[model samples]
Target: MHDIRFIREKPAFFDKALARRGLGSVALQLAELDQRRRAAQTAFQEMQAKRNEASRQIGEVKKQGGDAAAQLAEVAALKEALGTAEIQEKALGKEIDDLLMGIPNLPADDVPDGKDETANVELRRNGKPPVFSFAPLEHDAIGERLGLMDFGAAAKLSGARFVVLKGALARLERALAAFMLDLHTGENGYTEINPPFLVRDEALFGTGQLPKFGEDLFRANTGHWLIPTAEVPLTNLVQGEIVDEAQLPLRMTALTPCFRSEAGAAGRDTRGMIRQHQFSKVELVSIAHPDASAAEHERMTACAEMVLQRLGLPYRVMALCCGDMGFSAMKTYDIEVWLPGQNCYREISSCSNCGDFQARRMNARFRGAGDKGTRFVHTLNGSGLAVGRTLVAILENYQQSDGAVLVPEALRPYMGGLDRIVPHV
Candidate 1:
């Protein structure tokens, strides 16, 4: 959430930032609401003062043996007016709060200005797209041909945008997730965590996924929301918390099945796990001191890139434009892995620096040495790599003409020493 005081003090700056996201200025509307809220607050305070004075005057009249009826009536009237003002003040405050929660984080100064991904800038590329002896089939085609990925069964059980990984394919998915978790925890200094797959509304709100993107979530009948990403829970671990500055950089990683409605993603990548209702991901989150967030952002991105590097997968890092950033991200870097099947790059991970945007929403703060005040800690999250997408990359990049898939050397141990996945038949 944005600081209302900051917006009030510098409406133009806020509006200009919004403009870069292809949004019209909300500054004027917000200012009007703030003004009304202040006016209502002032009225309530004045009425409160009047009520106190009337009470004192009434007591004096009674003590002096006067009727005191007029003063009593005046006090009663003031109380009624004060109650009305209090309600108005509360309403106006809520209005302002709602508005603030809806506003996306301001793009950092370095973020490129654009309306969408078309304007994203490529930062760097790694490795090379594998040479194919024959035309590479997409992940789904490879999985289906191997008779382990069953989309028909998935659809029968859960409708569209779902798939069931059987036998070696299922093991491959699990191996990918385990590989990512081990890499992130052992090599990247991230503490491995297993978080709840279901969370509360406040948790989602704190992560900037509520009130605006609720449509993209899966809400249970019991009111708990199926997590869209492990980041939601990992980053929210410090919600409503105050930490000592000595623990400034808290890094956590989790491998979990993420559930999303994909409400607005209809018809895109409908054929494969690329756009699925449920998929596994190894997520990385960091709570860092405000001064350290920028460096942490780069470090986090590198950690994700390392996953691809170790797998020998060709990928590129993209600096997302302002308009393409997530609601909670001040800046984002998308790591797109080359898909031989698609003959192009597809996003496999997104690393973002929220720059206190989420911390403010969660009221997560840190107390430093010699500081009488607390400051919000900066939050960052990234996909160490989406497991399903990683599996897709592996299958497409390592497929042999005879339909066998060579296992990446790093994952062979997790695959029980299996070197390749061949058709069961």
Candidate 2:
């Protein structure tokens, strides 16, 4: 959430920042609402003061043996007016809060100004797309040909955008998740966490996934929402908390199944596991001091890159334009892995530095030595790697001309020394 005082003092500044994201000016509207709220608050204070004075006067009149009826009536009137003013003040305050909550975070000054992903700038590319002797097949084609990925069975059991993996293919997906979690936890300074897959609305709101993207979530009948990523639970560990400066950088990792409704993503990547209702992922979250968040962001992105690096997969890092960033992120870097089957790169992870945007919403704070007050901690989250998509990349990139899939060497141990996925005959 944005600081109302900052928005009030620099309405023009915020308006310009919003414009960079292709949004129109909201400063005037916000200012007007703030003005009304201030007026209501002033009225309530005045009435409260009058009621106190009238009560004092009534007591003096009674002591002087004079009729205090008039003063008492006057006090009652002020009390009623104060009640109305209090209601008005609360309503106006809520309106301002709602508006602020709906607004996206301001883009960082260094973020390139643009309207969409097309305007994103590529920072670097790693590895090269493998060359195949014959025509390469998409992930679905290979999985289906092997008789291990069954979309028809999944659809009969559930619906579209679902798939059931069996035998080696299922094991490969599990291996990918385990490999990522071990890499992040053992080598990346991230403490592993087994977070709950279902969370409350407040947790989602703290992570900036509620009140705007509610349609994209899977709500359970028990009033809890299925997590879209482990980031939701992992990052929220500090919600409404004040951490010591000694623990300034708290790095956490988790691997879990994520559910999404994909509300607005119709007819896109529908043919494969790329866009699915449920998938497994290894998530990375960090809470850092304000001075260290930028450097931490770069380090976090590198950690995610290391996963693909170890797996020997081709990928690139993209600095998303202002309009392309998520609601809670001030700056974002999307890591897209090469998919030979689609002949293009698709997003496998997104690392973001929230710059206290989420901290403000969550009331997550840290106090420094000699500091008089607490300051919001900076929050960052990223996918170490999307497990299913990594599985997709592996199948397409490692496919043999005869339909066998070679396992990446890094995952050999996790796969019980398995080296290849031979087609089911």
Candidate 3:
């Protein structure tokens, strides 16, 4: 999804960025394919021009009342040549697209160079881990004891890594989602969107989810994929569009159920709802002018952080190093919420700025009044908050000694102004 023109101009910088991401030597391969594609296009154009000129010559001979047989023969030969050239050009076009689609987005200049999440540098830590008097129980143990969570029922209905919340817990989950959506649309400048949970292959490709990372998705019987996040639908709204510059920064948000196959993640956080086949999330997406994307990245992260902050949850923001970033993110910031039960912090949201990477794939662009030609709009998306994970964090952080869960003040209205979840079997 990288701009081939950028690679053509500065392969060194591109390769260096890739190197920081631990993807060694992609610039040379891309440059070679780009070269071959350009050569084929030029050759095919020359042949087509020759065929057109021969056709014109045949017409001129006939008009002069002379023998046009030689000119017609030449035209026929050129047409045959053009047919082959056209085939070659089309084949090259597909090949080049495939190559570019598989490439990851280049990391931003500020992203640190590292191998894994462990190397992620913390930017800010807010609030303090709560002090518990009694033996703190994990969210599952407390929920099960209180008859609010039922994993056994979930297993019978679906499979593992799933949970069925009853009574207050179910309401709490809904409240979390409602709270997030309200924060994004009611306060933030993002438009509210309701999109399809099931999308086609082309939609995924436009959002940089396909032609790579196919294993991470759940597909229907007919090959359509369930969305892993609302980001896919929200961000692809402008695919193949030429937007007016007046609407430069198009921000949109949605609350939807995300489905994932988790093919690569095994034996990791399988005990609880940490990794599930289905979860609810409030997602934020921006179609920004290239000049404003960098600033918008920070603003978007703050918007996500505000959710945890308003909930009075302890959390920290981490700047993900190059290797830890997602395939489509040039830069990313992860918001990790405090989990008192685990005595640590866990990621509840991630915001990314993909500067023109997905725009190129989708051919999403905007016109400028100045001399500058049409330019691709930058794209950004983040979990305003993962509803399921936020629920987990809240349960653990707000647990009472007597096994009741206190609802955060912000969610009181959503929960009918209830203060605590007093469970009854």
Error of 3 at 372 (Å): 6.7
Q: Which stretches of candidate 2 lie over 4 Å from their true place?
A: 52-71
On a 0 to 1 TM-score scale, where does candidate 3 land against the true structure?
A: 0.96
Per-residue lDDT tens digits for candidate 1, residues 221-337, read 999999999999999999999999999899999999999999988888888889999999999999999999999999999999999998989999999999899999999999999
Candidate 2 Cα lDDT to native: 0.93
TM-score for all models, in order of appearance: 0.96, 0.96, 0.96
Question: What total of clashing residue pairs does each candidate reach?
Answer: 0, 0, 0
Worst-scoring 10-residue span by lDDT in model 3: 367-376
lDDT scores in order: 0.94, 0.93, 0.90
What's the lDDT for residue 8 in model 2? Answer: 86
Q: Which number leads on lDDT?
A: 1
**TM-score, cand. 2:** 0.96
